[model samples]
Target: MATDPYADPKLEGVSIRSLPKVSLHDHLDGALRPQTIIELADEIGLDVPSTDAEELADWFEDQSDSGSLVEYLKTFDLTTAVMQSADGLRRVAKEFVEDLAADGVIYGEVRWAPEQHLGGGLSLEEAVEAVQEGIEEGEDAVDRSGRDIRVGQLITAMRHADRSLEIARLAVAFRGRGAVGFDIAGAEDGFPPSRHRAAFDYLASEFFPVTVHAGEAAGLDSIRSAILDGRALRLGHGVRIAEDLEVVQQQGDSVLVTFGDLARWVRDREIPLELSPSSNLQTGAIAAWGKNLEDHPFDLLYQLGFAVTVNVDNRTMSRTSLTRELALLAETFDYRLEDLEAFQLNAAAGAFLSVEEREELIELIGEGFDA
Candidate 1:
């Protein structure tokens, strides 16, 4: 077994990084480049911790690993500060997709709250358009490089705010233009999805796909509201749903577990768990289980038949990639290539893409694994 967590391990003589992957819970503002942040900050007359790219990267890693949500969120304050301008948002979005493409991601959904970008005086529509322009540029760049990538926007609303209804409308309006889904983020503890009922009701009427950030900063009640009120097609993190499970007995490799109603509903319905292993550990989302990856309950979730998908929620903050996430899981659980492929299949099935497009993704994943 490899002692290095970041090193890629061969799964049947094929590197996991080379496998086609789908990212369902990655954040846009959370994946900024260090050099880009320094330059953008300079242009806007804002101060940054380090002007040198490498040092700035180290600064981010240190702050995020500080074990404080407040400290971790301060990094985004710097990133979003630079993203207040149209050019900045466009450049960041473009580079975001390009980086993912280089990292071997074939399909990804970049989620960010547009309401956070309007401090620069751009309307939500203009902000959305700027991001769309950048996404198209990145897609074109990937195509020119003989690689193909497709990324969609998951327009997000801040759960602590009251603009979800408007944000939902914006997301649905741009459905075909780049936006594929709706989500609510920020301060998941006090603000449950019930606060955004109007928005959820409107989205349900419009048939827009929704995902809510639950089970990270809160518990089962929050997740219940996310489903009942937000009509979430997917649960962001959703790790706490495991709390509802009662492990009755353990017999070596086999155990008898009883599930609560919510747990049963989510599992039986195959609602995807957008689990970001490293991020969950950093945010203390899985702290109840244990501190290390081995204690994550991720293996249990997988074995229990949850549609669990691996992700890097924030690459910059987590100092991780999809490859690193998979590598860590494999090292912890001794998973094989088939286990990794199962996660990809779950993500492909849960993607907001049409049935035909999703089938194409499934076929592509199967082919990649076969090769």
Candidate 2:
């Protein structure tokens, strides 16, 4: 991989890593450290693409860069393979939070399908419990380091699978225990959120929050189903929501646009769009627009009043963090610290926490940025 501008760079004379941020669409399976994967795979006698950590990291980036969604999906097979065991799950969960804290994240939600971790004979409950244990441990470590951080699971159901209702129940059952929300992830094109109406119905009845993976591989209808059927408060990588917009022209530092009903509603209603910059590029989610970060409709969405929040969909695959993602966006759009702070505030408000807690996070972000 070539050099990343924000790998460890400072912005406005302050390290972007030092400013507070919030991550809403991160994946537990996609944030593992390369070295952790090596050790975990070795313990389970699983073969990896490379033995060395750096080489393994490179392999992930290479495979993900193929621009084929199928190839991008293959990278998860390697990650979830080693995560089937309790120890592997716990360690990865612990490191996930630590990494988030290190990157100046005050709050984050790590979403993963519990069903996929059952190959090692662990029950769904056991998998959730194990990850919870690791999360608590990670929080303690960060606290001892004199920083505050919290993580919650967005219990996910594979959209193509038949376990939607079951996973919905699982997520609701773990509420206030470790799980904070529910989600449906996986092949979004054919397996629309409407396919799991029963699950969404159950979640809605129980008053549990849901975020669906839509508008990434698919387009507007997928997002509509995600909102109408899934009843999702947030759209995971809803970048394709841009499809609903008609850009008339781009003037100097301004854009003229028209919105379809769907786009207008999402914007006016303030439904959060969890946009991941690098992952969207790598998975070809933004291919319709263009290939580079500047081509991303993120600026347009922000300017148009959509509740946009930045994310790192897969940290390892994209080799990115929230810090790096914000940096790249700043470089692409010439955003200042206030622009970055606005993104963090959007995420904090959209977080699945109590209103009071979200307010506190907002204050924390203000303090961090003001410092």
Best-matching candidate per TM-score = 2
- Which runs in model 1 stand beyond 4 Å of their true positions? 1-9, 68-70
Tell me how many clashing residue pairs each candidate has. Answer: 0, 0
Question: lDDT (0-100) at residue 347 of candidate 1?
Answer: 98
User: Which candidate number has the best lDDT?
Assistant: 2
lDDT score of residue 216 within candidate 2: 91
lDDT, candidate 2, 34-79, per-residue tens:
9999998899898998999989999998989876566788899989
Q: What is every candidate's alpha-carbon RMSD to the true fold? A: 2.1, 1.2
In candidate 1, the residue pairs with backbone N, CA or C atoms under 3 Å apart (3 or more residues apart, or in different chains) clash, namely none
TM per candidate comes to 0.97, 0.98
Q: Record all residue pairs in model 2 with backbone atoms less than 3 Å apart, i.e. clashing.
A: none
lDDT for each residue of candidate 1 in 1-371, tens digit (9 for 90 to 100):
22554656576688887899999999999999989999999998999998988788788888887544556677798889999989999999999999888777899999999999999899999999999999999999999999989999999999989999999999999999999999999978889999999999999999999999998879999999999999899999999899999889988879789999999999999999999988888878887888888989898889999999999999888878898899889888989999999999999999999999999999999998998
For model 2 the TM-score comes to 0.98
